[model samples]
Target: MEENRGIWVFIEVTDGKVEGVSLELLGAGRKLADKLEVPLAGVLLGHDVRKISAKVIEYGADIVYMADHAVLELYRTEAFMKAVVAMAEKYKPEIFLYGATPNGKDLASAVATDLSTGLTADTTMLDVDPEKRLLEASRPAFGGNIMATILCKKHRPQMATVRPKVMKALEPDASRKGEVIEEEIHLEESEMRTKVLQIVKETTKTANLAEAHVIVAGGKGMGDKNGFMLIHELAKTIGATVGGTRDVVEAGWLPHDQQIGQTGETVTPKIYFAIGISGAIQHVVGMKNSELIIAINKDPDAPIFDVATYGLVGDAFEIVPQLIEKFKELIKEKGGEISYV
Candidate 1:
């Protein structure tokens, strides 16, 4: 236990803003910190990155370790790994948390390997065991039917990557403040392994699953495009967002960002509407962390019912329209707009 130390959260950022999963990790990290009675630290890397550092404290970081460099601005796995490895070597934190984003996972895997520490990826839950000085990393296995807890025993810095929206970000207390641990990278720009010659941002309909309080997702059982559209309409009337299972996304009915499953974006909306979804194990892994789940499928025995707070046996097309209308009425009475349409 003496070899293990404090917690470190990677502040994932893109488009000049910190990613949603980073905040969720902070919230989860804060719990681990309090339980262990140690500091919760955040690590950041990029150019002009100070802008996002303050929010980490507001969310719940006791200290922020920053290494702002031009090479780190864009996610070049090798360079990012170098900076992180250096930090770990300099200041050895017991546990390191990263988001499940492409960049985060790639860098974390490389860092964990180089540092000789174990890493758990796509974890849905995290808890620190004080008696054992262990970090319990929980993630779904065999689809969503089972969950496995991983431990990195006899490791100096245990590392884990968690899904976005799986854990709640603590509400910021503006009055709260924390220390910032500034760091510098001594390597010259020419020493970098990868060079970023040009950058092109993809233009696509990227969904806002992070900002959504309510999300309505349709799966293969939606029957076709029309069935999925009905689910989208319901999401609109409630001012909610629209999502889909991997099948729906593959069908080209929804964008990649709207896909919620083991290989897709993980979401934990306040209210989740699963329409015509068969509740495959992969799909369940992503949204099982949701606060409240409401499932509607014709099959009464669908696996979705296992975790749903509200389960209804009915046709999605028929039920979705009804729910949309009901939501419209409710929102209108209270004066609000449904944006999903």
Candidate 2:
């Protein structure tokens, strides 16, 4: 355990570009490393991904462990797992962080099993006990009612998978410099059990709430499907994206893709309008990071008020319609054209 000394973030590269979540993790890991007084390192693996090492350092990594190989062109579990495991055994980082994307989750789980270390999945918050040198990985637990912080007291490399959009990435610094250590992969394609067939991308059109600049998210307090129409009306009028709570999705008022909560997608918009939301921790965890949170609910003491920048204690039906009209008038004043994004 004493041999493990630095913080490591797995930099996921796709189509010759680093993933946003990887950059976010690098920003987060940098803080932990600074507090622990250890170097922040990034583990980069993929074919032709050497160019991304510089970006990783600009994001906050002091060192990048890169492995560039043809077999790693696509994300194959066997190939990635072997490469990461070998790096872990050699470098021995005190803490390891991965994005909660599909590929990241798969790789982290495999690596944790092989390394026999404890891992916390879907972590929304991360902290460290500098004295004890423990990673405090917290996430919604027991149906998202409360947050539970998991710790790996006995493990050498405390690993965690953090949800995307929950953490903010630091601004890039091109002038920042870091050391890139290239590692040679000893495994070949013949030794791998799984082979990449063909990749298929989703072509469906859906509400991209994660990337939306302004989001109007409603909860069950909106009454029903008809009441939910107000959410869409306000969103369309303002050119903002529409999102719903889990209850709204379960009631078939909105599609699952538009649900915002712990069990759904996490979002960080420039402005978030939480209408008729009671603000359960589950729901708050997804949108608490919004730059401006304006919550409207009938309950004067709704938990949403706790984290909201502005709280409206009234019926959303009356408040939202008035707001919609106000926005429409404002848009009409500006040549009937408004862009929120």
Candidate 3:
């Protein structure tokens, strides 16, 4: 453990750009590195990814270990795992963080198994003990009822796969400078077991709740499918996106993609309207980072109010309709071109 030094974030490149979650991890790793008084580094692995090392440094990495090769052009678990494992063994970072995306999770698991290190998956919170040099990775456990912080006491490099939209990224500084260390990949395309045949992109049009400026998320308190329409109407009127709690999705009121909670997509919109939500810890972990949280529930003591910026203790059915009318009037007053902000 004493041999390990610095914090490393796996910088996943997609479409020739850094993934948002990877950048977020860099922001998170910065704090841990600062606490431990160690340099923050990033592990970049991909073909033609040398140009992105500077961007990684700008985000917060003090050093970037890059492995540029054609075998890594597509995300093959075997290829990425070999590169990451080699870097981990050679450099020996104190902590390693990866995004909890499909590819990120796949690569992290393989690397952890090869290195025989413990990995905390779907981590929502991260902290480090300066004295012990242990990475405190917390996530919802026991069916999302309580948060359990996992520690890798015996491991050389503490590793975690963090969920997206839960952490904030640092402001990029164009003038920031960092060291780029290029690692040699020992694998070839012929040695790889998996090959990329073709790429199929999803053509379905769904509400981009994660990037929405404003979101109207409802829960079982909305009563039923017809009652849930109030949430849709409000969102539509305000030019916002519609989201739902797990119960709402399970009840067939909303699709799984629109679900917001520990098991759903984490979102950090500009404004989040949590209507008729009781604010379970599971649900809060997903959207608690929103800029402005407005929770409307008949129960004044609902758990949601604890984290809400504004709490409306009233019937959502009555309150939402009135709000819709007022918003319509406001839109009409503004020539039907009002922005929700």
Candidate 4:
């Protein structure tokens, strides 16, 4: 229970490496830490995961509380929840933030239930009330029409789960140091219910849309698969990733990973191309946060132009090919090392 009062981020590790969402949570946690004038801590739970805490330190953690046990090797909903609940019982942190992953949400919900504490889910933003000692968690509600901020006013360890890719991770600073506290995990392997049979990772034969800085995304306006083909050409020429709207993904023009909307992946690429898409509130809410949006649609009355930084009233089939040709020529002339990130 010593030195436990602070903002804490739940660190997620897969195959002994920290997840990007974990680092992103740390970055968000640092802001709350500064606001509260308390240390920003990272809570790492796993079996023999000592090597992971150093990376947490680089991502702006002022302290890391680690719980290593053989029973914690793989994620079990009950075991992890118990371990985390035990940690919470001891330290009593003012604020705790979790990534909105399947495992994260599962563990968080269970822990909140056990502790009889308040918990908010899929928060897009977080802030602290210095006067009330409250954690304000805001998330999109009812198809992104309204944003609701929830409060856990009475809970000692106020908790919220935030969506992935919604927050930015801080640049790693090797010089910025922190503290690591090793804890003894009291769970036995015999008490576990589920066992991990096997782990199969999904393979997509395309660029990681979430990681791409320059994303050329098409929506239903792309018309057909052929329309998406033109999008692919431009994206390939400029070394950008391809993404689509929910309509296109449902139509099988692209995979689910390439989907960029409310039910799909949230993106903030430097340049986003909305080809042939009539911007719906559902779609726009996701990519409206992009740095620069360029919309290409035949309909001048398309709702996409409202949020687009640049609007092109043209057919994507005709325009995308020209854009591809131009980009290839420009890159050929310049040659080598053009990064959109």
User: How high is the lDDT of residue 79 in model 2?
Assistant: 93
Off by over 4 Å in 2: 203-207
Clashes of 3: 0
Question: Candidate 4, 279: how far from true, in Å?
Answer: 3.2
lDDT of 1 by residue, 219-296 (tens): 998888876778867776676788899998899898788888877776777889898899888888778878899999
lDDT of each: 0.85, 0.92, 0.91, 0.86
Q: Scored by Cα lDDT, where does model 4 land?
A: 0.86
TM-scores, in order shown? 0.85, 0.95, 0.95, 0.89
TM-score of model 1 relative to the true fold?
Answer: 0.85
lDDT of 2 by residue, 1-341 (tens): 99999999999988888988999999899899999999999999999998889999999999999999999999989999999999999989999999999999999999999999999999989999999999999987898777899999998799999988777799999999899999998878889888878887764324378778899999999999999999999999999999989999999999889888888878888999999999988898889999999999999999999999999999998899999999999999989987754
Clash pairs of candidate 2? none
In Å, residue 290's CA in model 1 sits off its true spot by 4.6
Candidate 3: clashing pairs of residues:
none
Give the deviation of candidate 4 from the true structure as CA RMSD: 2.9
User: CA shift at 74, candidate 2, in angstroms?
Assistant: 0.9
Better of 1 and 3 by lDDT: 3
